[model samples]
Target chain A: MAKGTILSIDAMGGDAAPGVVVDGLAALLADRADISVLLHGNEPVLAPLVAAQKALAGRCQIIHSDTVITSDMKPSQALRRGKGSSMWNAVEAVKNGEAGAAVSAGNTGALMAISMLILRKMEGVHRPAMTALWPTLRGRTVVLDVGANLEADAAQLVTFAIMGEAYARAALGIAKPTIGILNIGSEEMKGHDEVREAHEWLRAAKLDIDYRGFVEGDDISKGAVDVVVTDGFTGNVALKAGEGVARMLGSRMREALTASLMTKIGAALAMAGLKTLRSQMDPSNVNGGVLLGLGGVSVKSHGGTDARGFARACELAADLASSHYRDEILANLARIREGGLAAE
Target chain B: MAKGTILSIDAMGGDAAPGVVVDGLAALLADRADISVLLHGNEPVLAPLVAAQKALAGRCQIIHSDTVITSDMKPSQALRRGKGSSMWNAVEAVKNGEAGAAVSAGNTGALMAISMLILRKMEGVHRPAMTALWPTLRGRTVVLDVGANLEADAAQLVTFAIMGEAYARAALGIAKPTIGILNIGSEEMKGHDEVREAHEWLRAAKLDIDYRGFVEGDDISKGAVDVVVTDGFTGNVALKAGEGVARMLGSRMREALTASLMTKIGAALAMAGLKTLRSQMDPSNVNGGVLLGLGGVSVKSHGGTDARGFARACELAADLASSHYRDEILANLARIREGGLAAE
Candidate 1:
């Protein structure tokens, strides 16, 4: 948003393509005057959309990319053939320092592969993790490695804790965020060997954040800790499961409030309150999945998200860029490495 | 409830102890006169509670035990020292064939250890899995390996699939339940090698169940599959996460509906519909975690559950036993083994 700062937009990535991208950018521009965008997509499609929105066109610089990554494309296939693609160019902008961050409503695998290949891993980082802002009763919690890697060792778990803590501080504005390792139980010896080892290391480590020993899956939504750390497999499953439950409950609630004539009247009266609750639980409100432990910030939005959701992803990228999340992560990683706290 | 069939009750287990157990038994007895129960606990604690309930006392036979398995006691410690504990005695009844099934509201790990040590694994079972009836949009779905073991190999997963299919047919009355492997993605190459291998095996296995390949966590509540199978770690986490989300959403809904006078009136008007929804979402309705792959039925009720919840658990145990779930699992396992479906 600041001078010489920009966020690259993958205009042709999502299901709705450049229209949603343009609309989302226009919506974002309505709120912030200083934010600039580098729009990457085919000029023929994007130019007309950009021209339609005067404010958005004034602030956005179109960067023509002939190729677009399909949602079904494999990561390996994308890697080999995605040169000059919209998703690729967007990530490249961040790596080349032309943009402070990149936001893409694209194929997640392809986006992750390109981000990793272009920005590379941060110093001393074993593996980068994908972090999502999970809505909780108290507020939002940062949950990590939500399908970045299937498994993580003790060292990688510890690294995730550090990165997640930094992310909470920068993105969520939680100073000295508390971190917890996700386990089957809160007991010290409850989970697998790697989890127990990470628990021991975190307990012994000297870190800025509060290290809560262990928490169960429910702790994520209960806001038991600011940062919830786990391997990608568990995190991914838990995230999706939580989402599924939320959806099921929501549908049930709606069905209940409209079951009869009297309930229909009640539903009308309760519209305001229901709206508030719906907004709180909306996925679009927390659309971005930030790829952490990388040299630059890159947010992967849901491929099926609409314009409003895509705007939220852009805002997440802008927030990370403005807060200098990468620098904070680097500082924290340096401390972790120097302390030799997460040695395998 | 059937003639010559009995359910072993751990009278000293659950948070509410003998009172809830007695009440639950009385409730069950009210509906069925044929079912009998063996109450295992300290004589002093059991006698008065049993004496207070005329129906329960008439149908129950006291089996005095000197010790009780405390909630905090480790599984190994309980296995070593809980020879005559109520929890241990209840499981022993099933093993001794004095009871058709065992129902306990005790520490899960201790119950699991006692059940495994006493009843023993069925022939050809690699590892027994814990199965749960998860509430879904369309009635209920069976999910397995919700924490019997932390890890499961390809062979074990295939075994779980067979066991889960049997449980669904018995408990849910589904003729051919659709089975799906819980993974991060539906793609064949999405998850770890074990998951992919199990997916391949299930696809090729000569089984009566409908194998639907891979399903993500969201599919659990979507009713996309009848049975969801995964390693204990992921399944446990996913189950808890789903529960947590339900709790959070429920609380939020209540808060929203009661925030204003208008909404309060609305809530009152929607009471009947709301009650229906609540019953559907209530965890107590599906209180038992059935331990499959053992020779006898063993249901682990929630320690914190009340009389009604415990009754539901007892009903689950009765259903499993009466339906001859063990024999069905054995036949399914034999078929799988004969087909060489899950050979390493």
Candidate 2:
């Protein structure tokens, strides 16, 4: 059993909050007997739900908060008026050492802003990046700067490389993950000056990571590299584009399968195969996005995810917390600083 | 018969070279009796191949060029020594007005450099973008800056919006194509300054296109808009990411279908549905990437494509030339200029 680990939860976050939150907690508690949860939300709303869930009754402790961070609130507005809010209180637990990590399914921008403001940046870290666990043919790969910082310089990109490598080690359990900078082409001359400069930096840096040169967009799904790094804007677009294609193909496949009676019977016969495909491509299986480069481990769950998905996010948070992800990142940054490899 | 339409072909551009090029031309000629072709390559090699195909003998005119642009040649080197080469001659024929359009399956960087040098940019167009025909749930949509120029300003993005709209109208037959700027989120406050600024300009510009504000990456394949405009870097990454996801799903599906004997039997029974799905997702069906913002239409076929794919490229080039795609782009640019909407 995992010891001295507690995950702070924003109970009122996400589209279908409170209910899904309670159910997800119940599921997580049933799956693992080692971890405890700190639920932050309105007492009246969460008290009954936690009481109803037999699995969560003893394992969960609710912290009453009257305010909820609305999805539509701007980052700046949220910062000014979000005190005592469920999201803010959850993150505060991480800052105050009351919990090992915090998980919230709220406005991404607000969450990022609050995480940055409260937890503060790690030593020698210029920008904090959001890392996502991308499913690939081999297993899973880590993709960072998904939407944390819109634009990144050559130095920031190199920083992302180090951060993502550390993230893969902690979350994905890859001891020495291969890393690649995402570019239009794999050639050294393919991308812009920033990407080229970062490529050079990574090549020269004496890091524990197996720094593979450059990888293209297709390489992400092929699992050509364990960690794919890029600017937030490009990463975000690529992530969404990949998802879009999956959805498009899935829908088209469904239409074709149902178009004829013969194909429908074939689908029934191949029920096991179809089930395998669904589980492999299901978004709920990989639902957490970790905010790296901060002093504490913070996770952002998809606001629209269901109970199963939320449970996956909680598992991700617990894993990061137990692994001492923040300490690993700090040590890496410290080594880079000592080596005089700062991008600035 | 379509009168005075001729497509200049770089016979030695692609991986399969003259074989696929000749076969593709034959396929195109069989489908359309109205078009003529200028085949540029070694006459000795191309002559025997062309003679074997009775359909191409009359309609094809051989323009012998000894030099073939190797795939690895740098753009600068190709520009310096590419004169009289097959790819060079094809673009030259367009510049010299002997051919209405040029089609090449050569190095993309070399092709773009040579095309820009020979054909020149349309008036008021700062950067010429590479537009691709992206297959969507509802037929096809046009996506631009697939890697033409790495970075773009607000003005250049607006230009892409216009160029993509015109291409969709000519190629996809969409009367008033809906246009959207690709960004991390659909909100106006989501992306960087340039994207936000371009969104504003597109909104204010009095154009024929139906401006649908901002769109995320998923919107591209959802058929939410007829034209998705973005910078070269983001567009290139998104395009490749989409391709990667398609390939990933395909390989995974095959694995699942062949896992056991029952599933294999099911696969055989559902072979027809699978065939339909394959065709719908096949990249070769839409193999051409049209170079927009040039005075003469230039279509780029994938270097690795086969005879059927090269034929699709020829069809795209011929279609654009016959539809007066260049004139339509110029008129739109003129409208934006008259409305004082230049990004510069």
Predicted model with the maximum DockQ: 2
lDDT value for candidate 2? 0.88
**Candidate 1 lDDT by residue in tens digits, B179-267:** 99999972324899999999888887787668999889998999899999999889989998888888899899999889999888887
**Considering summed lDDT, which 10 consecutive residues are worst modelled in model 2 chain A?**
A324-333
Across A125-244, the per-residue lDDT of candidate 2 in tens digits comes to: 889898888889988889988988888998899888888887888788888899999998723358988988889887876665689988999999999999999999999999998988
Worst 10 residues of 2 chain B by lDDT: B183-192
- Residues A77-105, model 1: lDDT tens digits: 99999999999999999988899899998
How good is the docking of model 2, as DockQ? Answer: 0.68
**Docking verdict class for candidate 2:** medium
Task: Estimate, for each residue in B1-344, the C-alpha lDDT of model 2 and write its tens digit.
Answer: 23567999999998999899999999988888878899999999999999999778678999999898899998888999999999999999999988989999999989998999999988878899998888889988899988888889999999898888888888888888999999887233578899889998888877767899888889889988999999999999999889888989999999999989998888888888989999888778989998888878889999999898999999888888888666777787777888887756
Q: What lDDT score goes with residue B161 in model 2?
A: 88
Best by lDDT: 2
lDDT for position A16 in model 1: 83
Q: B34 in model 2: Cα distance from truth in Å?
A: 1.1
